[model samples]
Target: MLRFFFVLSMITTASVSTSGLAQSSSVQTAVDKNFLELETAVVEAGATPIASIDHARLAKAEGVEMPASRVLIFSDPEINTPILEENVRAGLDLPFRVLSFDQDDRPQIAYTDSQFLKVRHGLNDTQALNTFESKLLEVLNGLDAAPAPTSELFADYGVIELRSQRSVPEAVERLSTAVMGQDDTVWFGEIDFATEASQQGVALPDTVLLLFGGPAPGGVAMAGFPAIGLDAFCQKLLVYANEEGGSVVIFNDIAALAELHYGSSAEPHHGLNKRLTSTFRTAIE
Candidate 1:
């Protein structure tokens, strides 16, 4: 019994050490990279970093504030402005609402937009949603309006996906650091991922921040589902970004939302195809 316990204790110690090392490594690497340009812009706008953002005006609909999770839906597919469409297609999904909460798990604000809401009614799988999310974030995270596509060899990203297995809070911090740079002017809205779950009537915790931005020039559009209907969305976000200099739109529970809309009775695949084709033409046209 003594021998067995000794072995077990050694194993436990090693495991703890490994876990700590991994976490420390993650933090160190994250600290080295740049991310959230929009958030930095908002702060540089001379507004308090934690100012009470007008979520209603930003999101264009009614939104609610909840604990660490909030959901804001963009329902309208047609109301997308040219800039919004390009940006959305470029991977800036037109955020329509924001839900903010406090560290004590208290509700803060629920803001929504009428013009931005458009029922997805499509996209049923995590794979599809992942592809969509990856494409959009690539553009938003770009230091320039046109950041090059990621390479597959990148530790956390490739041509289309930028994922970090780090904790949600940590990932957000890293992204925020990258974004809040000198001369970066923008605003941001925060919504909890749990808000998305609640909206879908499910229970899930996926931290996602939907970013919107100010306009300087129109960016190029890529192909695939990300390309579809994105022009409209991007146009809206860019306009918002240009006028306000930045916006913080939040999202949680991306998987649940993808499943809800994609699994619905509507022809999800067809919708995706149509959107993709339309995006291609819009970009070229």
Candidate 2:
């Protein structure tokens, strides 16, 4: 119980409601000030600020080079609880993200559509999910924007379909224990999608997002290649009903993510990548 409280405090402190809480980099981008302005603006929009990771500073400190970058994750638990009640895996996209970056002197801001997040995970509780989309747009409009982006979110994810030998709760308990059993630390948080949805006057299949990881493995990988941190901070165990109504888990393959982040299969990351894939397999099987 103490461990759970510590993890919550750790993540939340990095994303306080007040402005100026962000850990930023010295490298400036044209759009940098916009994000600073957004910190306050996002609050006015009624969302809970989660955390912000400055990839540029994080990478530079680890002896790697990256463009000026910042990623912000925010949520309105009041809004999310109702939706997540119906679709637990929605947590994957919960606490939506807003990103700012400078490339070749041009600063740009980007965000993922909550709808797109559901599509990638194969969730279809459209009405409930739309609330997440709308809330995200509400926050984004409070700031500034570039042209509408056509790119998909989580394009690097390699999903796996595993037949669940145990129920969602059983799987989660097993996986959580496995995580703590690891020599290095790992932390996870779970959400009850079905119950949350039922409370919202909707029905959804039993679904869950078992999100867990630690800074050690992902951080080491980031030191090896900082860009991967953008996508690899945490890996998820998505337990949901497939078309047949049987339970299965869908997750992002670490090896695939390494390949995507490195842009063309860097053999150097093969070792960590394999270990990552193995870890997920052990939890589910």
**Whole-model lDDT per candidate:** 0.27, 0.56
Question: Model 1 RMSD to the real structure?
Answer: 22.9
Best by lDDT: 2
Any runs in candidate 1 off by more than 4 Å, and if so which? 1-159, 199-201, 217-285
Q: Over the stretch 113-208, how does candidate 1's per-residue lDDT look in tens digits?
A: 121222121223344344433433433343322211212112211111223334545554444444333132233343343344345454333334
lDDT of 2 at 216: 49
Q: Could you give candidate 2's per-residue lDDT for residues 93-207 as a string of tens digits?
A: 5556676665444566766565555655565667767787777677677555542222434532455556756666666676678767876544544555555556656676776
- The TM-score measured for candidate 2 stands at 0.64
For model 2, name the residue pairs that clash: 85-193, 85-196, 85-197, 86-197
Q: Which residues of candidate 2, in runs, are more than 4 Å off?
A: 1-25, 28-42, 49-71, 76-91, 99-110, 118-131, 142-157, 186-188, 223-230, 241-246, 255-262, 265-273
TM-scores vs. true structure, each candidate: 0.27, 0.64
lDDT, candidate 2, at 225? 46
Clashes of each: 69, 4
